[model samples]
Target chain A: AQSVTQLDSQVPVFEEAPVELRCNYSSSVSVYLFWYVQYPNQGLQLLLKYLSGSTLVKGINGFEAEFNKSQTSFHLRKPSVHISDTAEYFCAVSDRTSTDKLIFGTGTRLQVFP
Target chain B: EAGVAQSPRYKIIEKRQSVAFWCNPISGHATLYWYQQILGQGPKLLIQFQNNGVVDDSQLPKDRFSAERLKGVDSTLKIQPAKLEDSAVYLCASSSLQGGEQYFGPGTRLTVT
Candidate 1:
């Protein structure tokens, strides 16, 4: 079984400042990691995913995340956040050898202020 | 090119009432999924289908929830005798294949009063 943990429930950042949302997971086997962003009254949008290769993966909207195997972490980061970046972010995981059943963590709400 | 599609973007029903939601995956996608997202929480998988075959439904509350994907493209989810706890956003997502990046539709927000 695989489970994800997003440490912060809410993060407030100033516009143009950097931000990071922490996420950790527990799995007995290799896993696939993903980040999704949800705007008000909208569906989830894929930010990026880590299936293999380099630890750092970039996604749309100038967002990125790094997969740290040893730490069991996949933290999302943005060098400069915009006001439009304020939204709910989710961290999800799926076991590599198993099916594509994604297990998501409690979302982190990002509030980017001017 | 188009993303996953879902119908009746919002619904309201009394407890013990029944309701249903529908979904249409992106063209050529081979997998579909149903998830429940309660307020203040992340989405939880209720069921998964690969083409028209059931893949996993471990988290589904069998007594009240049921879902089906017919013809490998469209799907429906039903909840009978809905409970107050069933009030949440029901999300539908599809992927090109198993373990691939999924695209989601605007969920149906079910409010069971």
Candidate 2:
């Protein structure tokens, strides 16, 4: 079985400040990693994904994540955040050798303040 | 392109009552999925459909939950005699490929009183 863990439940940052949301996963086999953002009462939107390329992947909205295989982690990063960036973020994993069934972590609420 | 669509954006029912949710996937999507998200938790897969056939339903509660995708476009999920634990957001997602990125719909929030 595969599982995802988001180390922080909530992260608070001021506008124009850098932000990082931590995520870790446990899987017996290789996996695909993804980060998704959800606005209030809205569905999730893909931030970025790591399928089969470089260790560092850039995503929408100036977000990026690095897939660290040795650490079993895929942490989302943003050099700067805006007030509109306040949303709930999720980390998901899918088994590489098996079906593309997403296993998601609880979530991290990003509260960008002015 | 239009994303996945789900009906009954909000549903409230008493315990033991039944409820159903409808979803319409993207025009050419070949894969559809249903997920349940409890409060403060991430979404959990309930079932997966490839066209009109079931691809995965291991986590779905067979006794109380049932889902079907007819004509490989529209889908429906039903829960009979709903429980309090079933109160959560039910999301529908679709993808062009089995391993492709899924586009999610605004979930149906079901509240069982």
RMSD of each: 1.0, 0.8
Please write out the lDDT profile of model 1 over residues A1-114, one tens digit for every residue: 889999999999999999999999999999999999999999999899999999999999999999999999999999999999999999999887875888899999999999
lDDT of 2 by residue, A1-114 (tens): 899999999999999999999999999998999999999988899999999889999999999999999999999999999999999999999998655699999999999999
Candidate 1, residue B25: how far the Cα is off, in Å: 1.0
Superposition TM-score, candidate 2 onto the true structure: 0.98
TM-score of each: 0.97, 0.98
For model 1, which pairs clash?
none
Q: Which residue pairs come into collision in candidate 2?
A: none
Candidate 2 C-alpha error for residue A36, in Å: 0.7
**Model 2 CAPRI rating:** high
Q: Interface-residue RMSD per candidate?
A: 1.1, 1.1
> Over 4 Å off in model 2, which ranges?
none
